[model samples]
Target: MQNFLDDNFLLHNDIAEDLFHNYAKSQPIIDYHNHLSPQEVAENKKFENLTQAWLYGDHYKWRAMRANGIDEHYITGQASDKEKFLKWAETVPYTVRNPLYHWTHLELQRYFGITELLSPKTAENIYEQASAQLQAETHSTRDLLQQMNVKVICTTDDPIDSLIHHQTFAQEQSSFQMFPAFRPDKAMQTEQPQVFNTYIDKLAEVSNREISDFQTYLDALKARHDFFATQGCCVSDHGLSHLYADDYTEDEVAQIFQKIRKQELITTEECNKFKSAMLVYFAEWDHEKGWVQQYHVGAFRNTNSRKFNELGADTGWDSIGDFKQGEALVRFLDRLDKENKLAKTILYNLNAVDNDLFAAMTGNFNDGSVVGKIQFGSAWWFHDQLDGMTKQINALSNIGLISRFIGMLTDSRSFLSFPRHEYFRRLLCNIFAEDIQKGLIPNDIPWIGSMIADICYHNAKNYFPFNDSAV
Candidate 1:
C-alpha cells in the first residue's frame, strides 16, 4: 500500500511521524557497546569494495545467505568481492519480512542514497557504485562513523589486551571517542583448563606478574582493569550462557584454581565456585572504580560444531539459549548488593522468554543510589529486530521506568550498523505515539519529545562516564 522506506516508512501515525522526525532522528548516537575494531578506526581503514564494507565480518548476512541456499564461497570463502555482493544481492528479495530486508535497504538508502531495491538485476551496478564511494577518503572508517554522528564507541576488548590502539585514539583526540570495554570471559572460563591457562599466561605477561595462584591471577586481572581505567574505560562486559553464584569459600575457590593450574579436571561444582568467585571479585573492582558492569547472557553458541570447527566462533552458528537464569542471576546480584558492591549494572538477555523476568530482575536492587542503576539493557543480538525491540521496550515500560533506560547499542562488528539506532528510535516513538493516540498516555508533545530524545541520546550521555568532550 505505502511506498517502501519513504520518510514515514515505519511511523504509523501523525504523532509517530512528528516524534521521530522532530525529536529522535537528529540525535547523536552513543554506541555504548560494539565489537568494532579499534585498529580499523585508529588507522581510518578504507574498504576495498562494498563487499568488504558490508559483507565481510557480518554474520547476520551470512546466516541469511545460507538460508537462501547461498554457498560457502559466496558467503565467507575465497570468492571475489564482486561475487559475494552479487550473491548477497541475489538473496535480498528472499529476505522479505526479515529484519535484514529493512536493514539492507535502510543502509543502502542512508549510506549510498540508493532507492532502487537490491536484486540480481541491479547487483553489479549497485556494487560498483557503492564500492566506488567506499574508495573515497571521505568514506574511511572514522569518516563513516562521523557521517553517522557517532559520539562514542565502546569496543569489546579482552583482559589480556595491550589496548595500544585505544591509547592511540585517546592521544590523537579523535573527533569521536573510541574507548575499550573490558571483557574477561576467559578469566572465568575454568572449564577449559588448557585454553584458559594460555589466556592466563597472556594476562600474566601483560601485567608483568607471575600468576602461579588464584590470588596472583586476580591480581593480574586487577592490574589490567586498573590500566583500562587509566585509559578512560568505565565498562566491563561478560558473555555467558548464564550467571554463576554457587556457594564456595575462598579456600575452595583457591583449591579449584590450583587444580586448574595443574591442568586437572575439576567437577562442574568446582567450575561454578571458581566462576562465582571471579564474578564477585570483578564486581567489587568495578564498584570500587565506579564502573558499569554488563552481563550478556543466554547465548547457546557454536551449536553446529562442524561449521564452528571449520569457520570458528561468531560465524552465525549460534542461537538463543533457554538456560535457567533466574535463580543464579538473582543470587549473583544479591551477593554483590549484600556487600554494597553492586556497580551500575546492565543485563541483556538473548532469549525473548526471559524479557519479563529480566525487567523484574532490574527492579530488585534499584537502591536510589542512581536512577535506573540496574537496567535491562536494550534488546540485544538477535533480539535487535523490530518485534523483539518492541517487546523489550514494552516489558521494560511495564515493569521498570522506561524514561531512565540507557538506550541502544550496535553490538555489531560492522560500521554500517549505526542505523540500527535509528530503527530502535522509530520503534520506540511509534509505541509511545500509538499509546498516546489510544488515550493510554498523555499527548504532551514537549514532554514525550524530551523522553524520545533521552532514549535516543541523552540517557546514555548521562549514564556513561565519558566527559563533555566525548559527547
Candidate 2:
C-alpha cells in the first residue's frame, strides 16, 4: 500500500522526502487569490452531498460534461444527485492527464480517504461514500478548508460588493482567513451603456459618493480602493481577453463617458483606448496603495452567447481566446515601471506560449530591490494542469529562476480543491528530482527540498500578505 501523500512517492527518493516535508508546517493555506463565495464561508455550510459540493458551483466540470455530450437537464438541471454524480464519474475517467483528474482523485484521497479510481463502474459506490462523508461535520465547508491546512483565503471581489461577509469572516475569525481583492473589470467598459449606468449607481451607493461623469467615477473607485485598504486587502485583480495600450486623453474619455451614459456604442478602437487609460489609472492607484496587482489575461469569456443568456456567467461557454498579448503587455507594464508605479505583480495567461512572455516580463521589472520582484503567477484558468504547470515552471527555469517563483494557487471556487496544492507540490518535487537525477540540476537534496517547500508553501507567505495578521 502506497500513501498518496508520502513525500518520496512522487519524487522516488527516500532522501528527497525529508527535504521537502521537513518543516512542512501547513498550519494554514494563505489562499491569496481565489473566487470563493463569501456567503458560504460565513455560514459554514455543509454540502447536501457530493453533487452539491462538487458540481453545484463548478463551471470547470460543467463545461467538460457538456463537451462530452451531456445535456443541460442532466447538468445544472433537475437530474437526481446520484445521476449527476454518475455522469461526472463517467467524465472523470476521460479527464486522464487533465488537471481535473488529479484534482478529483487527490481531493477524494485527502478528504474521503477513498482511493478507488473513479469510473462509471465505481460511480455509485464512490458517490454513496463521498456523499456520506460530505454530509459529515468533518466535510463542512470550513472544515474542508481546515483539512487542507488553509489558514487564510482571499476572495476576488468587484468594486461594488457590500463586503458584509468579509466583515463577518473577520469578526468571527474562522480557520480560513477571508480577505478581498478589488476587481474592477466592469468599470472600464465602453460597451453596454445600460449596465454601466446601473453599475455606476451601485458604485456610488457603495462608496457613498455621487458620480456625474468620468472624473467622479474615478473618484468613487478611488474612495472604494482606499476603503479596501483600510480593511486588510492588499491585492487587486484584473481579467481581460488581452492587454490594451491605446493612449487616450482625459478630454477624449469625457466624451466617451457622455456617450456611455446615453447608451451609445463606442468603436472597438475607442473602447480599447478607454480601457487602456482605465487600467493605467488603476495601476497608479495600486502603486499608491502599495498593493499587489494581478493580471489574468487571454480568456475568451462567453463564446456561446446563446448558452450565456440562458445559464449566465461561467457556464461551459467560455474558451481560450487568441490574441497578440506580448507587445501590448510590454507597453502597459513598461509605462507603469518607467513611472515607478509598478507594484508587486502577478501575471497569468491562459495560453501556454505566453509562459515565456510572462517569465521574461518579470525580468524586465526586477529593479534589484526584490529578488524576482514581479512574479509570473500560478498556471491559471484552463492551464492549471500538471502539463501546464510544468510548462510554466520550465519557462521560469529557463528564463527566470524557478526558486524565486511564487507558485500554485487554487484559483477554484471549490473548497475541495485544496488538494490542488498537493498535486502542484508533487509535480514540483518530481520536476526537481528528475532534473537532479539527469544531472540537469545539482543533487543537493536538502537545498532542493527547501526550495521546493518554499515554492509549495513557504514562498507564498512572504509573496502574499500573510504577515498582516489583522484578523
Clashing pairs in 1: none
lDDT of 1 by residue, 169-213 (tens): 788856789889999998888778898888889888899999989
How high a TM-score does candidate 1 get? Answer: 0.99
- After superposition, candidate 1 runs with Cα above 4 Å error: none
Clashing pairs in 2: 28-151, 29-150, 29-151
TM-score of each: 0.99, 0.94
For candidate 2, the per-residue lDDT at 312 reads 90
> Per-residue CA lDDT of candidate 2, range 349-452, in tens?
88897788889988988889866679988888787887888898899899998888777888888878887777677677767777787888788876786787
| Clashes found in each candidate (C-alpha, N, C closer than 3 A) | 0, 3
| Model 2, residue 84: C-alpha shift (Å) | 1.4
Model-by-model lDDT, in order? 0.92, 0.82
Worst 10 residues of 2 by lDDT: 19-28
